[model samples]
Target: MNRLSDKEAIDLLKHGDILELGQQANKIRQEKHPGNTVTFIVDRNINYTNVCLNECRFCAFFRRENRKDAYLLPIETILQKVKETQEAGGTQVMLQGGLHPSLPFEYYLNMINTIKTAFPDIVIHSFSPAEILHFSKIANKSIKETLQDLRSAGLASLPGGGAEILVDRVRKIVSPKKIMTDDWLKVMETAHSIGMESTATMVLGLGETIEERIEHMRRVRDLQDKTGGFRAFIMWTFQPGNTQLGGNKLSSWEYLKTLAVSRLYFDNISHIQGSWVTQGQQIGQITLAFGADDLGSIMLEENVVRAAGTAYQMSIDKMVNTIEKADFKAAQRDTEYNIIRRF
Candidate 1:
């Protein structure tokens, strides 16, 4: 295939035939992976607090600091969840939360230290760019200094949340109070510079133009060209059930088409994750043929998407079966996308 330009990507997204897109994407997936193995991680998403200061219009997961339901999970409760995840054979914990108004920067540092101190083996893939930026502002530090401190405190990697769309125009409408496009990229760039690798994500169907969708991918692709720190790229449709920015969900066809295009466009990035949590099991299964090499996680728990009124659960056996039925060998992977065991 010729080099995929921005105009070309948008054109395909707008008018590509579904099967053709999948075929082209699957061809790339075969070349990139060169095997019948599809990977998943056994992990849990633990939200420490839901008290956010920057209440984005697209979020249903955050509450004002003094709201009746607002909360910060006690350290004991957090540790207990970690214990449960460890007992369940989970290898990683995704510790993401809302931006609490008054939580000292030390609170996050100690949270990382506490988890590492207890579960030294667990990969603490925690925090989004927004949270890190918030931490820097509250603590009067630079983004680099903040990430360095978290790394010292045992932050293993970053979960690519908070990157709705990299276009400032879409950002202004959806999440004006949150960090803008440049700040999000700067956070990822800084993290990469400090030797802490992370993933990049796009939450589509936020009323962005087809051109804007490709624009988001282009920014990530350009950055990956420079830093090579982005280990994978994950794209999911925006869930708009209970949020302030309520809208219809994107169709499965659109999701799969976008996923396929992403696989073809991100030629430099190694892995593309199929999101079962939001897309459901069967569609996620189809993603293997649509250019996804990984089936994402058997999330022990997920609340953010749940808050948006779409929830799907998968046990380890179910995850294995989904891949098996799709004609690929199922393998458990770690945070770095290394296959740990095959089923």
Candidate 2:
């Protein structure tokens, strides 16, 4: 198989032949994995707090400082969630929240330390690029310095949210107040440099062109080529409900095409996760044959993307059943894409 160049990659995606692309992607997947197993993680998105200062246009989750619903989770409540996650046999806890200006730097460090202290076995894959960019502003430190501090404080890796679209023009229109395109990449690059790995994600269908999406993948691939720390690449459609930019959602078919395209393009990224949370369990099952090896977390609790009106419930058993129904073996994994259990 020839490695498709950038232009060839974009052309194949824009051709809009999902079935053909999916078959091509499956070939690549078989060649790479040489196994018929699908993987998922039983995890919880423990949104530590929702009090954010940066009110981006596309978010419906953040509240101002004085909003009645704006409350921070105390240390005890967080531990309680961790206990529930442990009991549920979860191996990952994704801790992400709004960029609250006053939540001092120690607050995040302390939170990670406490989560680690209580549940040392559970992988803590918390904090996205948005939080790190916010932390840099509040702590008056470089992205590298902030990441170093968090890494020392038991922060294992980052989940690439707030990277709605790495194109600044699109970002300016949607999440103008969020970190710029370059800063987002800078944070990830710095984290990779220091040995902390992360999974790359994209919220497509935000009126971005095929070229822009390819460019974003290229950026991720280029960085991964250098550091080799990225574990997986996940892409989902933008849910445009209860937000200022109230556009239609991307159909599951379109989402699959893009996901398959990502698998074909991001050869350096070993795993591609399917988003049952955003796309539903059935299409997510189809995505297994469309170049996705991992079904994303069975989120015990989710908010931000849910706040945008996409709350798809997926239990651990259902996730496993769906994966198996797709004619592949089902396995559970941890945050670093490590296989934990096979069934």
Candidate 3:
């Protein structure tokens, strides 16, 4: 099949029949992954702190430094969480946190090093490009320098957080103080340049036009062409309960249509992950038919979405059953998308 041009993708997203789109996307998925196997990762999102300087309007999780409930988790507490995750048979720990102003560069280096030193087997897929940008300014280092320092301190890879959308117009209205589009791409590019792979993510219903959504994918696809660094593409809806940008969630129909379009648009990227965390189990299951091959993270701990008043729980048994009910073999995967065990 020929690559989808931006106009072609936008047209499909706007007017293509939903089932037909899914059929095309499913065909592509089958071509890439022949067997009826869907993968998931057993991991935990250990947010170290809730203090944030950039108060994004779309976020309900962050708090000012002086707030009574704001916190920075002690290293020992974080280690305990990792220990619990390991005991639960988890192979990855995602250590994300808000951009606290006072913590020195050594805080992150020490945290990553401590986690790695204590748990040598667990993958530390921590931090986002926005946090990396914050670290660079705090440490008086270049982005590349900061990334290299973190990588040296045992940071394995990056999670595709903070990339709500890649269009600056949408970003300005939603998260003006956050890292802009190019900086996000730059951070990912630098990470990929140094062999630290990461995923690409998009959030729908951010009031972005269909063209803007396709533009987001276009940038990611262009970057992947330059650096084959993105391991997967994950998309989900914005939760808007306690957020300053509070509004209704987009329908599952729109989400699935966009997911199918993402499958067709990101032909250069290999995997697409469905968001059970935000969309719940049933829709997560249906995403399989829409071209998603992985259900991301049976997260042992997640607070961002919950903070926004949306929460869904998934256990290993339940996760396996979700995949099995979708008529695909359920398998546990690691941070690198390597199959760890099959159920």
Candidate 4:
């Protein structure tokens, strides 16, 4: 059967015919990866600073520069986190932080270089579209130049945060200060044009229309069509706890339905992630049967989602058992989404 389009997707979504969507997407999932094995990364999120200038309504992680807990995480603390990640058998360190307005471009370059200099093997998958855009504007440099500099300093990839929803309508409402949809796409395209690959993510249940949700997928699909640099597409319900954009959490069924629709709709993208951080391990495991090929990460340490008061606990053994209970094999992967070890 042919996969559904926008209106068809809306119909499936409304009818909650997620099983049908799952069947359609699972066909493709099996076609691409024919096995019970699901992949995850051994990574830690090293939030360099919580001090942010663009305080989006949906974010509870960022604080003012002078706030009590806000900090720039002097390079030493970041290195310590990286060391801790490595000690725990982590292969990647996600260096995600806020858009600190006063930090110079050299600050970031030095941070990347310093980390790379110490732990040459750790994959430095850092920054989001918003950070990149901010870097471009603050450093008075071109986007290409900024990305290239980071790459040269040993940044491996970009985590696709700040892409809450691609439609300007929702973007303006939630994240007025963050980069526009076009600028976000442009950064990814430019990064891919060089040699870097990245992931695409969406945070749902933030007052966007169903059409807007599908449009978000369309934008990601279109960009993937152009740059083939997306390693996987991840979707999770937005955690609205301590932020200005307070709302009810989207149900697991709604998240799973949209995830299945994303798989069925975006043919070019190969991987979809099951976010245990926000969805809990049970549904995260169920996501595999629902068309997700990867189970996100064994985040040794995480703060952003934890700050939202929605965190799940999992060690490698627990992660493996969770997937096997769901009747899938569990595997470990690196930053590039490449399988390193299978269990």
Candidate 5:
């Protein structure tokens, strides 16, 4: 496939037939991953705390510091969750949380070290770019130094959250207080510089235009060209049910179309993930034909999306069956997209 210019991508996204777009994306997927296999990981999303300093308009998961329900998970409680994840056949834990004003940098280090010490083998895919920037501010460290410290403390990779859209125009409206576009890229670049790989994500339907969506992909593709550190690109429609950014959910067609366009545009990134967590099981299955080679996670626990009132549950057996019913083999993978088990 020829590399698409930004204008060409926007044109295709705005005027292309949904089925044809999906076909083009599926061709790319087949070329990249020849085998007819969809991969998933067994993981749990552990929110260490809900107390947030940045009260973004699009978030339903964050609480003010003084909220009655705001609480941080104790180290022992985190350990127990890790133990449960291990027993449930999980290979990774996506530990993310909102920015807390009072938690010192040492608290994060201790959390990472404690989890790694208890479960040496489980992949610790924790923290978003926003969280990293917060740590840097409080610790008085550069982004590179903060990433290095986290790596030394056993943070394997990043989850690519808090990146609603890379365009500052949309970002200012949705999550004004969070780190902006360049800061997010800097965190990923710094991580990649130190040999850590992470994924890139786009949360569409944030009242962004088609051009803006293409712009988001262009930024990610440009950074991938520089570092080649991003393993995959995942796009999900914004869930606005219970959030301050309330609007009707985007249609399944829009989700699939944007996802398909993302696959075609992000030619540099290797994998595309389908979000069953937001779109439900059937659309997740349809995504296999539309360019997703990975079905995201058989999440043992997910809270943020649940808080937004769009939760879909998937067990190991159900995940495999869904993939198979879509006429593809299902496989389990680790944080780095390495296949672990095939079914």
Candidate 6:
């Protein structure tokens, strides 16, 4: 099949029949993954601190430094979480937090080093582009230098957070103080250039138009074509509860339609993960038929979505059941998308 053009993607997203789009997407997914297997990772998202400077409007997780509830977890606490993750059979630790102002650059390096030192087997797929940019400024170094420093300190990969829309118009409205489109892309590109692999993500219902969503995917696809460093493309709906950008959630139909379009658009990307965290299990199950080959993260611990007032719990048994009931074999994967176990 010809690679989807920008106009073609936009047209499919805007006007194509949802079922047809899903069928096309599922065909592509099956072509890439002929095994009829769906994967999930046993990981934890340990938000070390809620204190932030770039209080993005769409987030309910961040707090000002002086806020009574704001916190920066001690290195001991972070290590404890990593210990728990290891005990719980988790292979990855996603150590994401807000942009704390007073924390020195060495704080992050120490955090990564300490975690890896304590848990040598755990994959530290932590940090975001926004955090990287913040670290660069804090360390007075270039993006490459900052990433190199982190990588040397045992940072395994990055999570595609803080890339809500990846268009400046929407970004300026939702997160005026956060890193903009070019900066986010540059951070990812630089990370890729240094051999650090990562995932790409999109949160729908951020008030971005169809064209802008396609544009976001275009940038990611173009970069993947160059570096081939992105292991997966994960898409989810924006949870609006308790957020400053409070609004109704986008319909699951719309979410699935866009997801199918993403599967079609990102021909160069490998995995398309369904977000059971944001959309619940039923829709997450439906995502398999719509082109998703993986249900991301049996996230052992997640607070960001809970802070936004959306919470869904999943365990190994539940995750396996969710996938098996959908008629696909369920397996646990590591940070690199390597199958570690089968159910």
- Regions of candidate 5 where Cα sits further than 4 Å from its true position: none
Worst 10 residues of 6 by lDDT: 331-340
Best by lDDT: 3
Cα lDDT tens digits, model 5, 51-79, are: 99989998899999889999999899999
lDDT of each: 0.93, 0.86, 0.94, 0.88, 0.92, 0.93
Q: What would the TM-scores of all predictions be?
A: 0.99, 0.97, 0.99, 0.97, 0.99, 0.99
Q: What does candidate 6's lDDT look like per residue over 1-343, in tens digits? A: 9999999999998899999999999999999999999999998999999999999889999999999999999888889989999999999999989999999999999999998999999999989999999999999999999999999999999999888988999999989999999999999999999899999988889899999999999989999999998999988888999999999899999999999999998999999999889999899999999999999998989999999999999999999999999899998988888899999
- Per-residue accuracy of model 4 over 17-96 as CA lDDT, tens digit each: 77887887778789888876789888898888898888899989999988998887878888998998899889999888
Ranking by lDDT: 3, 1, 6, 5, 4, 2
Give one digit per residue, the lDDT tens place, for model 3 in 154-177: 999998888999999999999999
lDDT per residue, candidate 1, 277-305, as tens digits? 89999999999989999988899999999
Return whichever of 3 and 4 wins on lDDT.
3
RMSD of 5: 0.7
lDDT of 1: 0.93
lDDT of 5: 0.92
Which runs in model 4 stand beyond 4 Å of their true positions?
A: 1-3
Q: Which stretches of candidate 3 lie over 4 Å from their true place?
A: none
Lowest summed lDDT across 10 adjacent residues in model 1 is found at 1-10
Model 6 ranges with Cα > 4 A deviation: none
